[model samples]
Target chain A: MSFEWPWQYNFPPFFTLQPNVDTRQKQLAAWCSLALSYCRHHKLYTLDVLEAQESPVFNNKKIERKLSMEAIQVVFEELRKKGNLEWLDKNKSRCLVMWRRPEEWGKLIYQWISKNGMVNSVFTLYELINGDDTEGEEFHGLEEWMLLRSLQALQTEGKAEVFSMDDGKGVKFF
Target chain B: MDRFSWSSGLLEINETLVIQQRGVRLYDGDDKAKLDVGAALLSTHRLIWRDVKNHECCLAMPLSQIIYFEEQAAGIGKSAKIIIYLHPTPANKEPGPYQHSKYSYIKLSFKEHGQIEFYRRLTEEMTQKRWESTPVSQPIPTGSATQTGKTRAVGIVGIERKIEERRKETDKNISEAFEDLSKLMVKAKEMVELSRSIANKIKDKQGDITEDETIRFKSYLLSMGIANPVTRETHGSGTHYHLQLAKQLGDMLQAPLEERGGMMALTEVYCLVNRARGMELLSPEDLLNACKMFESLKLPVRMRVFDSGVMVVQLQSHSEEEMIASALDSVTDKGSLTAEEFAKLLGLSVLLSKERLLLAEKMGHLCRDDSVEGLRFYPNLFE
Candidate 1:
């Protein structure tokens, strides 16, 4: 499926940090929302600042305006402040994007599991994520870290449990 | 006052202007008769006192009517005067400013240090009695002035009545000055001063002229009018014209600068200066060129160009350090501020506030936090 871009992606000044306090504030907000929605549309689970700058989300080839690396970091920092992002390392070279929180993902996975009559059923992490039976699901291709976090949320709520077996990581739905 | 008759400032056919003293005031006996700092001209035929701003409020009497005159030495808070005792009003007296009075004498108070010269000339003219020898030449043409023979008198009345009478007089003089362009040019200085005095009187009585700020600001601009703007035709062109223009601009900017928080945009100064000059509009190039001489000419106000290329006219009294210090204070008080917020706090424009904030930042008294949330300034904790 093709990813949809926000209208601000075409604006040239959006790449540059506005000098005016009020204007810059609005620009930052737009950047934050655009960054989040773009990640959500592409199902991007992680982002590198430099790599993101090269992406269509940060660089508009038609307008020839590229969001500076520093500006990208600023947008990421704003997202982190809002709890939608987390730096992968102390150096902030890469970041994990969470357009949907772990708890929200857990709710979706649980709803799917319950609809599929999978209660009390055991399944490997790969089967749960890449399994054919879970195909056509919203979290069908969820990343490992994101899947693990969602499973942990369900485990905390006593709805599901995960175990490391000789074969591989597996989950048992309650 | 009754001994004086309404007269045009024009000289009689055979008469000539002998001496002229500006800043001379007339006294109705001892009371200030609202003669109000006029230009007193001693002609070959008569002594004429005309309001310096209102050319219409002129009074004259034949020098022959002076019984005698003597110099009254200046006292504290009082100008030196020449008290002239006049012969009683003749039964066929020409219509004058007042109908009756108890005092038979009037005083010419010289406020501009010309009492001695005027007194000497008066004595010489009185001894010579030049008009008697010439008989009575035909009265000079009164031009388009309306016949002002309406008998007006100072009545013993309340303060309200006095204010009403003054307003009437002001209205008449203003109308007369507007009779024609040349006539207005001749009387512009008189009108400016007259308005200034009236404004002062209103301010004194009411604490302010009006609740409307635009009206007050307009009146203020009008009151500082350049009565005689240096024109290329009169002062000639080149450096001298610009110098005179610069000087005139300096004189005209003092009050406005004080009122506008010691700084103004060059455009605003141009607007205000042209407004004060009335029809004599100044070109932007000329204004810029004239302002360039402000520093060398040692004017109180100067031209300043911001780093962003905006030109401002500021009073020399407002220093950069003071401006930076004020910006720092506002930032510290507010904890943090944007240019718009700072502008609101200081009653300044966003451009000026931004410049001030940048200045403070340059001084290390403030720090800028520029983010997607927009830029804000905070007092520099490290400094």
Candidate 2:
């Protein structure tokens, strides 16, 4: 629940986006790294800009400096360009933080399924995400869209089958 | 006469000979008693009578004070005489009590038949119109004249002889030269020559003075006079005057620009050009226009306006690459470059230095660090 911020987070100019081109580029890069690291430490998959405005990650209370919404959007845009973030809506009020790429997540899921001997068994998306049997797993309580994308990646590799039932989406591995 | 020569040795600056008649025999009034035989030179400003036997005993009279000039017909026994009546300058107007009466008339007999008529017409032309409207005053006596009678006067006769002798020497020539108001054209040339000689003397004594003092003295001499001023009357049209003035300004800026490392702020250039110009000062707009004219003329100097709106005049040979290299060297040596520090390195004003630093930053030659200590520049390591 606690995240140790980089030393630059306390630097005042770090919160204020630099106006110079080169300085701004470096500042954006720093912001992107800080955002990703902070999100990963808290296991935060969704970042709401309005909510982040009040969070310690975006607002450095010791320095009395906070990134403007526009500055935050610019940093997020850079992250999105690097395939590290996905805008959830047209307004970009929220973004899906890809702490790990879907391909990497798909490989992790395959390892988990093989270790549990569930290679020939079927499981509901709900069980795979929030089931008691999958407790303490990295994919536990993962967002459905991200989980489905990871499963689709696995299906593309011919390692799993995805099906729909009245209960919800299901995945079968062979 | 046919053998007469109006030599430069006899004429002073601004003294143009309007008429010269040789074999002219001057007499005392109409008595036909010949006083002295001399060659007469009529100038726009004065009449010079150089004694045929002794040129040192030459006499000069201002044409403005000439009361009358007449050509008398030849009597059976005498040749025609050209009579000139002169009103001696008033005692108060005269600087001292020298020889020559307060008012006198002299008659000159010429051997040439039409010479008297020619002298009459030339005298009319010289005296009819005043060369200058200002009334002529007697020339001030120099130190030599005043020293002669004052320091050693045993008796009135001795004093009179000394004054006469001094009058025959330098004072007479100088006073005559000064008495003519139109002689300013000649005086200006003399003044330039005199200053040049003084400047040379100062240059000889340069070792005695400090470098700063020497520079100050040289600048004083340089700004003392403008020999050929560009005026509307001299150049004829406004455009020509501006063009000529621009050329003059360009030439004048060369030394100062070199001193300042091939660049100077426009305001500084404006001040320098105006100071050198003295009376004929150009407006800032005129200076800017003149600078703009430099571009088309392919002059060696140029005017540049920085992004921050500061303008400067820099030489065409000035290289931004060289400036950047120097700036980088300074930054490396000093670690960081403030406006003040960069100003010293570039020999420019702080404001201008800051502008230059910003320009370098824009050009990717340097980077800026804006912080609590104010803006400082470093070499663009990012590039």
Best by DockQ: 2
lDDT tens per residue, model 1, B7-115: 6577767898899999998888887785578899998888898998889888888777778878899999989998988887765555677888888889888889898
Where does model 1 exceed 4 Å of error?
A19-22, B1-383
lDDT of 2 by residue, A1-174 (tens): 567777778655566556568866776887888998998888889999899988988887775777888888898899999888999999999989987778888999999999988898999999999999888998898889889989998999999999999978999997
Best-performing candidate as measured by TM-score: 2
DockQ of each: 0.01, 0.03
Clashes of each: 6, 1
Error of 2 at B110 (Å): 99
lDDT score of residue A122 within candidate 2: 94
Q: CA shift at B289, candidate 2, in angstroms?
A: 2.8
Give the DockQ of candidate 1: 0.01
Predicted structure 2: lDDT: 0.71
Model 1 B-chain TM: 0.44
Model 1, span A1-174: residue lDDT tens = 787776666545567665555556667888888888888898899998878989988888896777888888888898899888999999999999999888899999999989889899998899978989989998999998899999999999999998998877889999
